[model samples]
Target: MQSRPSPVPFPAASAFPKALSWVLVACLGAGLGIVALRPGQAIPAEDTPMEAVAVVPATVTALGALEPEGETLGIAVPSSAQGSRVEQLKVAQGDSVEAGQVLAVLDSYEVRRAAAVRAEQDLRVAEAQLAQVEAGAKNGAIIAQQAEIQRLNADQQARIASQEALVNRLVAEENNAAVELGRYSKLYDEGAISALERDSRQLTLEAAQQNRQQAAAELVRLQSTESPQLLAAQATLAQIAEVRPVDVALAQATVDRAQAGLQQALVDLNQTVVRSPRSGVVLDILAQAGERVDAGGNLLELGQLTQMAVRTEVYESDLQRVAVGQPVQVSSAALPQVLQGQVVRLGWKVQPQSIITTDPSATIDARVVEVQVALDEPSSAIAQRFTNLQVTVEIDTQ
Candidate 1:
């Protein structure tokens, strides 16, 4: 009874509040340290270690695709005397064709056209020969030669005048190109256009200047050769006695030979079927069945799809970072996995990005050089399914 009365005098102070007080103080200190420490470092009391990776080298990625080694071959139909229509498109796009297989056909009008051209040329030659004979009979060989020389001189003068006009036009074009190039340069600096566009404008200017120079050279050539040639011909003819029957006979022989050539041309015109030059898949049909195209107009394009190469465009600014033989990884949407390749070639020229992404504001004129990647065998098998297929290429520049 006495012990119990003594124990009731003191209420046991709860150690919980004191422990909580110490805990709060410790938390405050720790929080302060954490807030005041290096930005991303772990807590001082933490047991887990931080992990990191060492990154080195770099890579460049570009969009491009598989092009044939020799590029696509273009087939065309010759323009005839009369315009020819495409009678048939025998092979459609993506058709596999053999060498000499007909890809398209032109109407028979081309045959008639070839004959007409030959005839016109023969008629002109005959008329000249007759005039030579008549002039010789009435006057002399010297007079005939003089007349011919005058005619040649007139023709040369007309050519010179025409070339001079061309030169003038080319110069004006060159000047305009220069102005445009300067304008493009300014805009590029201001970010109004892509670097590719600026470079393309520069190319146009250079081509214009080159054309002007060529025209000027042609004009000089005609002028330099015309008078001397005519004078020499006149001097030579003055020494001849006459335009004889033998000369007329020789001229007739020449006409006969030309007529033979005309026959051959006519035969070719009948066989106006456009054929593939090699065994390959047709990539494009540039001409329609009913369209009429002149000689050298593109009818269709063909290429061997078995051997494939990825063509990527690298930007001019980043071109310095790329080199031949760099390891590349090629990927296409058609394939389930990435394919390996090597940088077989680096482009000497830069051009615009040809395969644009879905971005509407993509720079179509971005000047980039075409880099070709020879694909690995396994990758090529997949690429063979698609010709001119777009792919992304990553070049490791390590």
Candidate 2:
């Protein structure tokens, strides 16, 4: 029976086998071509209509670092202080500090403190002197000066009175001698007195006149000297009784000089103790006890870790999409959870990227703009401990 069927015309079976083989080959070739072309075309969503699919908002992604609200601060010694050594450290790493709180004491502390103390004493002394001058002479001194003036006036009056009395007595004697001389001359003329007696009377009258003249001249000289003495004593009393403007000014100037000295001393003394410029936590100590610090050299690293932020270096091409108040997403390997923030600032300059990746294929020469994102309170609290940690930032630019 098989021999009989084969012998019969079996063209349909042979044709079917050949056609099936060709069709199978074509199907395989078409599938290979479709797979080859698939890489160049976007894959269509399965079981979803293109019109109903939602459009994703555009975003700018960049590498960034976690920082404090203001950023990490390098606390250093005053510029004016050079080659200063740390004597004592009042804080340790991770210590919370307030603004203006003393962080360390320098070796110059004791010397500067002593200088300040001396300056303060000098200021007090100068102030006292100024007060004394402004108040004029003491009450007791004024009283004593007034009493001396009065005493001088009384002495002058007594001397003048004594001189006047002597002059008056000498004038009386001269008058009597003149009368006696007249009488003796008349007697001599009348030949009633001897020549020797008349001569002796004349001599006595001349002597009396000379004595009166001498006494009058002495009284005038005494009055001139005594008047000036009394006037000088009165001037001395007046000078001590009232405050003089020139004297007060001189005393006040001394006080001002002392005050300035004290202020300078205080400033120098304050420089001996390094204080926190802001409220923050100490991230690290750059200079330890017994270590020397140069001008502008760091003493410690500090940050306001209570409020955290992310500093993103957005590509210049994507910077146009970034703006203040835009929502941002920050992620880091060190962080347990994603952090949320909003763009608060955008850089005005475009510079070379600072955040370098370990990946050799990463674009290292790309220019970027700094974008500052302020984290929410909860995010900040969580990210504070990871300051300066590298992170990935995504900014939604819908």
Candidate 3:
């Protein structure tokens, strides 16, 4: 009751402080809003204290797949061994192999091996013949050859003398026949001789001329050269006296030819066996024993699993954001945790995206550039088993 009586109109001055507090609160909110909305705006020093803003690193993301350092390799038969079937597989899938290690043998192995053996035998025979030639003729052979040469020379002289005597006798007979023919012709022209007698004289003259010509040719042949037997005996004697360079050269040439043949045969034999070109693991075997290699002749698929990498296909538009040596993060449902890597290369060509996403809204026809990211050691060990596994990649652009 006393308070009601004393209740006077609230003073404007008393309400001034409360109204001032409400106005101050509103001004504070407006200042904070201005600072947040326009960060570049200058604030009065006497107003609110400034706070630091956090910054986040930017990133680019794309679909990717895990692979060996240099990607998978389809090991094929040597081109020289085309059309050959596999006779044996020395290594199976999952086996590790070193460069030049035998992985398979072709059907031509045994045949080629036999050919090589024959070539080797030929080489040995050639070498023996070369040694025999280089050693020169033995003393007993030299004596026999000299005696044969003397005998042939004596026989040639006697034959030449005999042929000369025969030539002289035939020449005399030819002259006599010519004189008789002249006489017969004169008699025939005078009609003093019978036609049969004239014909008989002509035949006698022709036979005499033929005999004379044969004798002359035989004499010339005898005088012109030594007997072939005599020449051969002389050659053998010369070879016995000293090893002729020509003979040695001929034998050496034979040896060289045999060696070349052996080399070629060995090369062909080696071709029958397929060897690895590099150290790697055999991921698959495309050809088995008794199986004919395909058109490509691929024998197996192999790769170096020691180091792993991610091949990411980034959109062409975002390619500018990627660079070599940049850090990367790779993740996949197949992996237990995120993996770390570094960008190592960028593709030179822009190609259509090959990896399709499960999300229907994704850009299926996006043009992309392949970017290679090499994984760290630990990450590589983890990814070794996941070759060709699709993965998500995040590249730090900062």
lDDT of each: 0.80, 0.90, 0.91
Model 2 weakest lDDT span, ten residues long: 1-10
Highest lDDT: give the candidate number: 3
Per-residue alpha-carbon lDDT of model 2 for 220-245, expressed as tens digits?
A: 98877767777887888788888889
TM-score of each: 0.48, 0.76, 0.63
Give model 2's clash tally: 0
Off by over 4 Å in 1: 1-54, 57-59, 79-83, 88-102, 109-279, 286-291, 294-297, 315-321, 359-369, 396-398
Q: Which lDDT tens digits does candidate 1 get at residues 34-97?
A: 7898988666556867678997549988888677767778876754422567888899888899
Q: lDDT by residue for model 3 over 1-398, one digit each (tens)?
A: 45545566777777899989999999999988786865677755786788889975499999999999898999888788888989999998889999999999999999999999999999999999888888887778888888898899999999999999998998898888888888988999899998788888888888998998998898899999889999988877885779778888999999999999999999999989999999999988988899888567688999999999998999998999889999999999989889999999999999999988899989999899999999999999899889899999999999
Q: Which of 2 and 3 is the better model by TM-score? A: 2
- What TM-score should be assigned to candidate 3? 0.63
Ten-residue stretch with the least lDDT total in model 1: 2-11
- The parts of candidate 3 lying over 4 Å away from their true place are 1-57, 139-239
Ranked candidates (TM-score, high to low):
2, 3, 1
List CA RMSD, all candidates.
42.1, 6.0, 13.8
